[model samples]
Target: MSAKVSPSPPLYTTFLVYCALQVAFVSFLFSYYDIEVGPIIQPVVKWVIEKAEEIPLVKRTFELLRTLVIGDEVNEENTKTLKKSTPKQKEATVEVHPLDADLSYLPVFSSEQLSFFDGSRPSKDVCLALLGRVYNVQKGHKHYAPGGGYHFFAGRDATRAFVTGDFTEAGLIDDVSGLSHQDILGIQEWSNFYEKEYKLVGLLQGTYYDAEGHLTERMREVIGLIEDAKLWKAAQTKEAEVFPPCNSEWHKDSGGRVWCTTKSGGIHREWAGVPRKLFNPGTKTSRCACVKNFGPPLSNYADVDEEGTRGDLDNPNLREYPGCSPTSNSCKLQED
Candidate 1:
């Protein structure tokens, strides 16, 4: 006899039965054990959705359904969200100004205007000018105010007097004409000191700066002189290293004495040289220097082929003391 086959249930009916069983199992856990299944299943469902989004067909299908249900608002919100998440490029801006523009943002003061701040006026601040730059010296009112020791320096550009030690009206002038390069360098140092110690107020409209607060031709010349002075000072330092100065001591009753040592003139070296008078070029002044007695001169060390056994003792710039021997390391100074 032929057996009759039973028809299978529909797929939708099977799915519904499986979902109902899962719901019953979750409800039993929640009621009997006080456990919730939503928290554990939520992350898993979200991960599955994220993975499905990677598939183009699934992603497009979901997007189409979402658009039909939410309309254009969702698309506009997504576009705005995308814009917020992305970085934007900044626009470039360029500004042009004249060469003599007031770039320092400091005020320009005339000599007459600067004179008001000399501590004479009770309402004004104590101020002074150096190298065309004005500095407020109110903090040092004791020294810059009226009847003070440095009162003459207030309210004026006394650049020349800083090095010359001349506090007279004629000497306190800003005119630094005919001053030596060393004097210019000294003025520069004083300017640096004021800049570091006090607050810069403005530019002085005088020899160093114009009415517009720009550097003038005289200021440029002074700067050039300062540069030359710097070079000269550097060369002098190098010469001192090569030929160290002698140690000297003076007494009222006893005579003065100058001697040489390996550590003289704050220069520590291996050689204890003999004393000699080193005359500065184009100047009548001279200083005692220690002369090396052996090997090539320190300045000529790079000349490999240059033969010298007497060291710097034979240098033309050096001369022995009148009463001292050529090889002596010490000399007793004779008072003229």
Candidate 2:
């Protein structure tokens, strides 16, 4: 028997045919969609396909499919990626806060237990703690992989470093309240990235969150401040977006006629922001004037508008002044 031992059988033809059909379907989707499935969905398809690697036949099927579809292109984006919105600058991102997570069926991990997830321990899972939440990043092996670029973050609630970009041991602590508003906002993008790219494992134990997972008083206060800052920033953005500064173009013709425009509701239309003393050949009475959008507002910046009509030399009154006329060549709208 040893002399005439036969090799293991090959994959059955029927199974290979089934695998071919499955791969063909994926290939068709790649060809039809042109590989531009937006951010949230394509990662899921890629992750699903990656699981096939555990089975050699299925892996072969995917390789065959990828070869037929992509033509052997080696792309780095196929695996790990990182996008950083600078620490000192705020990223214009808004998503549900990390505390609002829905972790109904995940195991709670203590600070000590987090060490088990670094791939150094026998545990087969890779995870990280961020902003009191744990995310299983086992799938993103290239970055979270053992001795990977982001390996320092593993087995730690390095929330501070996520905001500060300091991946050293000193920054690998739970104290993130000292971070600036912009830094916190920047970290939020990472939070959203993890939320989208990985599965939520559980919550982390620390000062901000009590052992019972309840928000501490300090945490509540800090969160309240963060929320207030977020609201204020949003209000400022909406104010700029909805009500822009008024600009009046001085016109000498038609006996002191002018046009004023302000960006309101996102349309460049007519606006009445001040009283213009027109000759009014028929009535001969001063009246409030409306003007079409001649150009961008006189008060270009929001800060300049906030200082509105006040005597601040840094941001002087740009609204139509009481005595502005065509002869003066200083006819600009100032809020009376």
Q: Which digits, one per residue and each the tens of the lDDT, describe model 2 over residues 120-198?
A: 7645688898777888888876787677899888887887887787777887776766665667666666777887777
lDDT of 2: 0.59
Q: Which predicted model would earn the best lDDT?
A: 1
Clashing pairs in 2: 260-291, 319-333, 319-334, 320-332, 320-333, 320-334
Off by more than 4 A, model 2: 1-98, 101-105, 235-336
Go through the candidates in order and give the clash count of each: 0, 6
- Candidate 1 matches the true fold with a TM-score of 0.65
Q: Model 1, stretches more than 4 Å misplaced?
A: 1-105, 300-305
Worst ten in a row by lDDT for model 2? 310-319
lDDT of 2 at 236: 48
User: Which lDDT values do the candidates have, in the order given?
Assistant: 0.78, 0.59
| lDDT minimum window of 10 residues, candidate 1 | 92-101
| Per-residue lDDT of model 1, residues 76-195, tens digit only | 779999999998877653232222335356798999999999999999999999878888999999999999999999998988898899988989988888887778778777876776
TM-score result, candidate 2: 0.44
- Each candidate's TM vs. the true structure? 0.65, 0.44
